[model samples]
Target chain A: MKLRRSERMVVISNYLINNPYKLTSLNTFAEKYEAAKSSISEDIAIIKKAFEESGIGEIETVTGASGGVIFTPGISEEEARSVIEDLRDSMSESNRILPGGYIYLSDLLSTPRILQSVGRIIANAFKGNKIDAVMTVATKGVPLANAVANILNVPFVIVRRDLKITEGSTVSVNYASGSSDRIEKMFLSKRSLKPNSRVLIVDDFLKGGGTISGMVSLLTEFDSTLVGVAVFAENAQEKRDRMNYKSLLKVSEIDVKSNHVKVELGNIFDK
Target chain B: MKLRRSERMVVISNYLINNPYKLTSLNTFAEKYEAAKSSISEDIAIIKKAFEESGIGEIETVTGASGGVIFTPGISEEEARSVIEDLRDSMSESNRILPGGYIYLSDLLSTPRILQSVGRIIANAFKGNKIDAVMTVATKGVPLANAVANILNVPFVIVRRDLKITEGSTVSVNYASGSSDRIEKMFLSKRSLKPNSRVLIVDDFLKGGGTISGMVSLLTEFDSTLVGVAVFAENAQEKRDRMNYKSLLKVSEIDVKSNHVKVELGNIFDK
Candidate 1:
């Protein structure tokens, strides 16, 4: 339906925000709102300014017969640091320390608000990379991967620890178990990922780095390339394989005897 | 940042869309945007009209000493039907059939675009219910639950088929397995959910309804109330105990030998 300029601007802003990284011709919006293409272009100009100024994201306009606009979601450094600091404070609570030095993170991972903010921060940290999919292990990593995938506007593939009949054909790999010295297997559906796609690996926690390394091998088997690795939190005490990665929070200390846990901003903020 | 009326409206629209089911007083926006309270109120008025006109959602204004506006995400019936119809067509593709009459839905579930639409549709169906969390079984149902919980702005609890030490203490329940006639156990972390929370159960597909039932019983152990149940699709041929729930698609027929499958809009659109 036709609307006033202000109302039309509001609706178009909603569309761009929801359909980030998508290219829509100005004519499409013009026809949908029953306005001139020139008017639609003007509305986008204003939206671009608003989105950039607020650090919500960046809007790129393509100029061609088939071009429109694309939104790359971003978070300001200030906002990102503030969000991670708040998470660090929550992670430091002594009550979150459980047996085996595991910090309880399920509550933070499952909450929508925290998940969305973490998603934006992670996605922004990987800016300028052409990522086609987000990869994570089953169970704990699903929501974190989902959140980041939602922001990147890409499909996410889950690597499972067990084989299921519903997955049809599958690809399997083995990695060293962190807690136990035994080797463990991980599986991914053959069709879940496409060959030659660039993938960003994400996880809820980083301990031995075994799981992430296992996923890296799976990527090679799929004939895909790894864009980078990101984790929600990392255990600094654990000595693992040295790998380049970014994390939102670092568990600097976890003393089970004293029931003490220390948390700080992760490598994502490191220059 | 201070902005013009049009640009400010664009930013405010972004805030409301990102933060649905949340209340923010005009003073907050007034202070942030460096605009008068009256101007901020006017911005919300225009936004409400635009949002309703486009069927994005409803904006409720709670007026009092400590009140502001709340956005309830919504989808128009016409749009919802169109989306469901498209999914029905995609589900009918014969290649989706597996050896044992299972449907391959990982592609659809993993895609952010489709999951977001399904989330809006499912969350909209249970609009009036006070949902404290979304519940589902692990491996397959995690993304579906995450989608719904994201829309509803609540945490989600996942019931696992196997025990993990990372979950700390958990409550386990037994249910009849659909594939195998043997009883299977499912577990939920003790601290993941609080007592007396109202939850909505979501899953990728419904066959024997055993898994959903398992989760429902698990809820009782936690002293949580069931708000409702929704599924992405249901198997029409499966003979199972009767249960009340909403489904987006129905697999009317699946012939593995002929490599044919029939799908149609589910009971979600039924009057």
Candidate 2:
């Protein structure tokens, strides 16, 4: 794989962008590029210099023979917005997704493009808001929380439906819901969220505002401020309460029982 | 609010890099920057052009007043490795993260920084391969799957422990565990994975390889090939039939009952 400099950069950038997780050894790069180890090292130096000079990325190298290279974490606001717009289009195809009264976000959530796009958009939305932490309910929300937290360089806290031994001394809040007659309790560690801190709540779907509302209460219990709530999709025509909300797709529910569904991109520009 | 061009790019790139999920509007950008809408637009055009010309990134803009910019989802190998090395240092601290009798990666999995770092590492490991999908079991594995899937632009399939969905039938397999006498059942959707596709298997921790071994069986059922198996942490001293695995961290078990925790960086490059 003796690639030209431009070709090498494309290959190298795509590799770093695609991986985003582990540091690679020089040997690993040499192996991937199928070039001499020295050449690979030189290419990496060039790439690192290019990244530093451009101010678009950073390269970190581990000392010793076992050490490798990594791309510093980042994406631009423009890039973030493009991702959301694509999702907005995808969510607009409601007729195709609503199967048996449930919006099949499973497919969308499971897809990387949509997840990466939505993740960046939300991160951009919360950019420079002095966000102390990113919070989400357990299960599906984990992915969204992880995406936003990564770019922000902050901790992500998960509010669990059931308490685990690992979390230790949890605080709980109850929410009223249709499926369960009794109140549903969501829990987070007493030490998980800081007091008077700015928090961004993220979730995969918002059927009713109940779950998010409970999370707000939980955050308040810790004396944290709710900066805003962002959802992958929201049923806005149903008129859910509370201000400061953004959604990639707004689902103006037509008829859930008849398996009828309609969706549109939300007012993304609306502050 | 009078930020320099480089400052604006840094802020914008940092936000997009952190979030990695959705699209943001130009209006949103204007609001974030508090700059003149025209100025913001010009800055964005310059940034986008720079990214494209350098072959380092792609910036997409949507037309009309509601539209804004987005970073085309991309990264380089050097960038990926650079981030992973930084993460390795951050995670090197023994005090910041509390120790337990058993390695509780639940915290790391739930936490965004660790998860994002892990995601980039795994993503780099499998970059440019014919990986059609990413697979992991429920709970802890979801976040990692999401991270890897996001970078790879693929789908992440979750294998459930139980048949919670009454509507759909599942394909199940049995696994022998190091802890329990009984064989555990791992369920996946019949349609979730296609035939002869390359799959990447990831998990929060690898103890006995029972789960990974089970997932291999499920993949076999669908005629899919195992592109790779990665673990956030691997208890390597405890030997098993399974070999050739990639891990972010390595733990040589200090006996199942001892109060010793020996944690070191996994030999990810050993592969």
Candidate 3:
């Protein structure tokens, strides 16, 4: 007996979710269903369109010989919040994350699987939102931006903390980050973004949300809109709102001088 | 008449090269050849494996009910030099690239198609090199690193100009970049790389070879071996006879403060 289209999609999505590295070709699906190749093709097109429309997963096609589709695991916003909370739980156990009242995420960001999963969850939250680009302040934010951009297939623009010989003339924006008394200048090339582009702002960590706001102001110079802001980790003690933004993990406070800290996972990755 | 494995591989590869975006499935190939689905599937497997072994292009699979394979266009090292030389020819028409004794690649790096081709060519040069990682300095190098990493399926790592709160404790190194007066500091997290890793260094441009040397030194601290070095452009003048690396385009010289420049395609893409 042949399965209904809905049934097939569910089965296929489940298969992709479980077998992350495995790829399947159309012939394989057709044989499994005892359906005509043409019908299978139609069914896949439907599934792909559904995935795109639903914004839960991405279906990539491989052509020529040895081609198959791999389903990337994605989560809805509510589900994403739970996952972030889980990571927060894991992070809170480590006393090393707080040294001098700061949440250290360098080790967390460097791990591939964590970054990959975090990236997917974050990207899924804004699927099909027509984000013109992903932007981040340079260095630490590059990898996070890269992961998000890869999932969305959009270009990632890195804003420099300082000018380099290669960057030519840059439009500089001034913003204070953390407890630094002096205002720091962040720069993006005038030509990096097009006019009226919609940008998704992402960063590894948020302390005061000052850098995030500065990026927002920077985007305005290009007439770009800020569609969303996401951070892998955020600290609530900073008393900065923009609670409007999505964060995977939230750190309430850290007493580095005393080596004590508190953490709260935002409800972003509920699953 | 049905096409044999060799014949199909060539034709399919050529088709992928020409069409670029259009992906045809095994079922489609079977229908085109009047062969059974099984036979076509087998043929595709062979082709995909061959691409992996030969490094001509990538065979990406699209799984699920209607998923199929797609070809991502890639070039060989020989082809890389040819394309680079073409760009070199165009860049040399005027001294525009040599403004202030530097070949400005900001405009080129920002261009999508150019970056795409450059990435493919570099990937080709390193095809089958067993590269474990792609490493680059921050900012402009990120785009090029992304392209090479995507094709190679290796993680790309970025070295920071300066450490931030997110980077944890960083291991810093100093190196002279070409003939520059000042010593530049490059940094990486102590744990970001494993000891004795095989790394491929990729950058957008090379001037004094100082940055490349710095990257090499940083890798050495982790006991990492330099597998190879690739750049989109290289300086032809003041050539270092002892260095082993590949550049897509070779720059002869740029008259100081003039828009005059000369360049040629490097031998890495000799074919």
TM-score of each: 0.99, 0.66, 0.68
Per-residue lDDT of model 2, residues B147-246, tens digit only: 7776566789888776644214569999987654669898886657779889999997787788888899999898999999988877767667746678
Candidate 1 lDDT over residue span B62-166, tens digit each: 999899999999999999999999998998888888888888999999999899899999999999999999999997898999999888999999889999988
Measured over all alpha carbons after superposition, the RMSD of each candidate to the real structure, in angstroms, is 1.1, 11.4, 10.7
Model 3 chain A lowest lDDT segment of ten: A13-22
**DockQ order of candidates, top first:** 1, 2, 3
lDDT of 1 by residue, A1-271 (tens): 9999999999999998888788999999999999999999999999999999999899999999989999999999999999999999999988898898888888998999999999999999999999999999998999999999999999999999999988988999999889548799999999999999999999999999999999999999999999999999998988988899999999989999999999988999989
Worst 10 residues of 2 chain A by lDDT: A94-103
Off by over 4 Å in 2: A1-85, A92-100, A166-169, A189-192, A237-244, A254-259, B1-100, B110-117, B162-170, B176-178, B189-192, B237-243, B254-259
Error of 1 at B229 (Å): 0.5
Q: Cα deviation of A252 in candidate 2 (Å)?
A: 1.6
Best by TM-score: 1
lDDT tens digits, residue span A56-140, model 3: 4666777767887766546565555666666777677655553456665655554444555687888777765877688888767
- The CAPRI-style docking tier of model 3 reads incorrect
Each prediction's number of clashing residue pairs: 0, 55, 38
State the weakest 10-residue window (summed lDDT) of model 2 chain B: B92-101
